[model samples]
Every structure is written in structure tokens, then in C-alpha cells.
Target: MRLSDVWPVRGVELRHGVLELRPMTEPDLPTILDRLPDDLEMDPTLPRYAALDPGVGRAVALVQGYWRAMGGWSPQDWALPFVVRLAGEVVGAQVLEGPHDYGAERVVDSSSWLVQQRRGQGLGTLMRAAVLELAFGHLGAVAAISSAYLENAASLGVSRRLGYADTHTSVLEHNGRQLQHLRLERDAWHGSGRGRAVTVRGVGPALPWFGLDGERA
Candidate 1:
């Protein structure tokens, strides 16, 4: 039997024009690692990303992180590690996180990273839009939230274009950096029509896994 037959989330998919966002699978790990930039730069202060050997060692950590998230998933709290593909080519990763009591709160948060070479191609905006669609449109999320380092204009810009508003700023202890937190309510998202063109599939069987009613799926 297919894995998705047992774990419906594995079958969930989102599409916007040429961009597609789907759950990251074990088989996809090698391709994702291969796409990693050879000269990846990281701040030495962040203990998590700072690896003595940033090549194979760091890649192993990332794959492990994905595995941990997948294995630890529950209705109370979960994360969808979406692999972003542009016209069938892996370009980046987008993650949507539902914290504890997600069913009661109906709030979700997201973060994404695009390949260095794929920067500035509007793919970032599309990737975020696609996931927000799955969150606010398909998953019954009432509000979608995100945060980005102050210096990261590209990420903030994507949030702005997608109708997110500045809510506050908080210090990121990992690097002692400040990031702007943004939020977008369902009404605002619907009015903005950002992800209107996006479509979600395989949500019916996944609804129960998300602590949501199966009827809407």
C-alpha cells in the first residue's frame, strides 16, 4: 500500500501556476541535499546551523530534522515540511507549522527558504502564497502568521505582497537578531486574493489528522 494511504498528509498537495508545494518525503531527501549550495554561508553564533563540517554533516542534520518532524507529528501540534517545485524542479522548501491546540486557536505560522540562485524570481511569493492557501483555505486556519529577520527584506516583502501586516518585533535569541512578526487574518487574505489561483488536493483524508472535521475536506 502507498504510504499516503495510511498517512493522508503525505498525499496533500498545493499548486499555483507552475509552482507546486507538497509534503517532503524520504525519497526526496537526496535531491534536496544535492541542491544544497556548496558554499553555504552561516553565522558562526547560531549553534544549530554552525557545523564544524558544513557540507555532509550539515546536510545530514537537515534530513534528520525533517524525519523528526514527520515522526513526531500529532493533531495537537504538527508541521508540514513542504518541498517547493517550480515546473517539476525542486527550488526550495516551505514549512507550515500548527502549534499545540491548533484546532482551538486556528492559527498557523510559516517559514521558507529558496535556493540562492533562485532568489528574486518571484518564486518566494508564490511558494508562500501556495502554503497560505492550504492553511487558510483548505485547513480551516483563521489567521496566518510569519516572521523574518529585519535585514531580510525579501521575505518581509513576500509577506507584504500577500497581505500580512506588521504585528510586532521580537528578538531571536539564536543570533541576537530582531525579526518583524506579521499576521494575516482570513478575511484579509480572502480580500487580498493572493492565493486565489492556488488549489489544494488530498485534504479530505488529511482533515482528521489536522484535528479538523472531515466534512469540509
Candidate 2:
């Protein structure tokens, strides 16, 4: 059997006009690594997860982590990772993660980043909207949760545009300093009005992996 037959999510894809988002397979890894930025120039308040770090070390860690995520997936808890492409070129990544019992909790969280040169052009918002469509429209998620550093205006702006509301705040220690966190949630996402048409493909084959196919007639 093919890999998608064993792990159905590998077959999923989302497209909006010239932009497309699909699972990052082994062949796509080198391109993603080559595009890694040497200097992210992110705000000091932002949390720096190891995978998002710049430099060779970060690249190695990312490759390892990506493979681990693919190998470790289960119905109990799984991460749906997608590589964002524009006109068939790899630009970045968008991800949605949730537990197997999501049907009960009805919640999922997301994280994403685009290449530095591609920033500020609203591709981030478009990428997110594609996944939000998959979550709320296809996966039956009742609420979507996200967090960003208080000083990260770009991220916060995307969340706001997508109809996410401030939920709470917390503090985390990042690189020996306290970083402010802004938690946001959207119980109602009525589309971002950004004029990008989105389409999801291969979800029907993956529905059983997410435990939703049984409910279908």
C-alpha cells in the first residue's frame, strides 16, 4: 500500500488561487531547509522555539523533528503539517494539531511562518485561512486557538483579521527573559473576507484517520 493509505493525512491538500498548502513530504525537506533564513529579525518578546531558530543547528533539528512527527502520528494525537506554496514553489509551512478526542473538545491550534522576503504581503493570512477552512469547515472544530508574543504585531494582526478574540495572557521564559504571551480564540470564523478562494482536497480519504468517516452515511 502507498504511504497515504497508511497515513491518510499525507494525501490532504488545500489550495487558494495560486497558493497551495499540502503535507511536507521527504522530497520537500531539502527545499525547505535551503530556504531557511539566516536571521529571522524577530521581536525580542517572541518565543523562540528550537525548530524556528535560524542557522545550521536549527535546520538539523527541524529535519529530525519533522520526521519524528511523521513517524509518531496516531489517532490519539496528531499534527497535520503543510508546506505552503505559491505557484508551485515552496514558501513556508502551516500546521494544525489536535488530540484524537477533538470531536469532544472541538478545538485545534495552529502555528506558521513564512520566508522573510515574503513577509507583509498577506500570504500569512491567506495560509492561515486555508487551514481554518479545513478545521472549522471540514474537521468540525468549534474553536481555534493561537498565541503570539505581545510585541509580534504581524502575527496578532493575522489572528485579529481572522476573527479571533483575545482569550487570556501568560508569561513564559524564553532565552533567559520573560516573554508576554497573548492567547486568542475564535469560536466563530465567518471567513476572512480577503477574497482568496480556498479548496480542500483528499479529506474524504483521511476522514477515517481522524475518526470522522464512521459518522458519514
Candidate 3:
């Protein structure tokens, strides 16, 4: 798919019960913050650096600023972010970055948290897979990358179940303390056991977005 001609955005209601990746509005901010964990951990390996702070509100603003600065969305060149909706409510956020400025490549990161009452329902796995479909099928990313702190078993388990392999481990800082981190790359994603089950849709114009002028590192 070539991202240069057009881009797709709408509520992608999935059959796995209830879900949607819709355009985020100011109203969505309140619910998004409510779902964040009180002790949100900012895994250093991840791009947005801070988490587990009492400042989820400030973080949301940062996300808004980051995407808005990506220039104009001309079908192929833009960075898109989404609010994960379930049962008609926004629960978490997903980021699909591509049509990159630094190099010719595209990738996505699925970061989310459910309210205290909604934990352990296998929702994370489903949500991550859905966004991955959007990246590989809709956004034409050669690979998707997801990282987690070694301490967070729930998040790490979701990645492992989805076929992510450890690319490397590094040290990260949060709360004036160091945590172990793991990076999962694309080749490992394809080799994952569950790669085939997630169905994808509307992937045609995403190529130019991931296509760079030269080879990617």
C-alpha cells in the first residue's frame, strides 16, 4: 500500500467483541486518563519516556503535540495516533508512526492500560494484535516494535504471546531506580506463533509511507 495517495481513518469495530480505533477528540482525554494506572511505569526503552507518574494528564498533552508536529497528512506522510475504544468508550491509546522524516520506514507501538476493575481479561492481547494488523496491513510497516520492562509481567506476557522475541535488553531509569528492558523487533514478530490469526483490512496506500529514499538501517 502507498501512503502518499490516501490514508484511512474511522471506527474499526472488530468482531472480538467490542473495539474501535477512532480519531481522538478532547472529550476522549478524560476517559483515557481515568484508565491509566496510578503507578504507571515509564519504561525508558519506549519513546514517550515517562509513565507510572501522577501526570498522565500532562503525558496526553505531549502525545497530542508530537503527532500534530509531524507535518501534514498527505495520505502517505503522517504520524497517526488513536484512542482505543471499547463498548463505546475510550480505554487506551495506540500510536502508528510512519511516512517517517528520519528514514524510509514505518512502525507502530501499542501502549495502553485498563481501569483497575478491567484488568486480566485478555484485553491487552486482543488490542495489541488489532493495532498490529493496522500497522502491517493498513500502514505497511515492515515490522512493528514493542518494548516492556522486565518487571511488568502482564505487558511482557502479551508481547510474548503475540510472537515478539527479545532483540536486546538494556537498563532504564524511572523513579531514580534502574529497570531491565527488552526490545522486540519485526523478524521475531513474523515468526511468532499467533501471527496468522489477526485479520487485517484496508492496506493499499501505505507503501510510500514506509518507503525511504535509501535502505533503512
Strongest candidate by TM-score: 1
lDDT of each prediction vs. the true structure?
0.83, 0.73, 0.55
Model 2 C-alpha lDDT per residue in residues 88-162, reported as the tens digit of each score: 878888888775466567677887888888898899888988988887767767677888767778888998887
After superposition, which runs of candidate 1 have C-alpha atoms over 4 Å from their true positions? 37-51
What lDDT tens digits, residue by residue, belong to model 3 across residues 1-217? 6533444343332323456665455566666656665656533333552454447544655455444624455434555556766787666665555544424455555565655666688777877777676565444466665666667788888877777656766554444433333444555655664546655433333334444322222
- What RMSD does model 2 have? 4.3
Q: After superposition, how far is residue 139 of candidate 2 from its true place, in Å?
A: 1.0
Q: List the pairs of residues colliding in candidate 2.
A: none
Off by over 4 Å in 2: 39-54, 99-103, 174-187, 191-196, 214-217
Taking the tens digit of each residue's C-alpha lDDT, what string does model 1 give over 47-142? 354445668765766676687678888877888899999878899888898986787898999877888889898998888899888888878899
The top-ranked prediction according to lDDT is 1
RMSD (Å) of each candidate, 1 decimal: 2.7, 4.3, 6.0
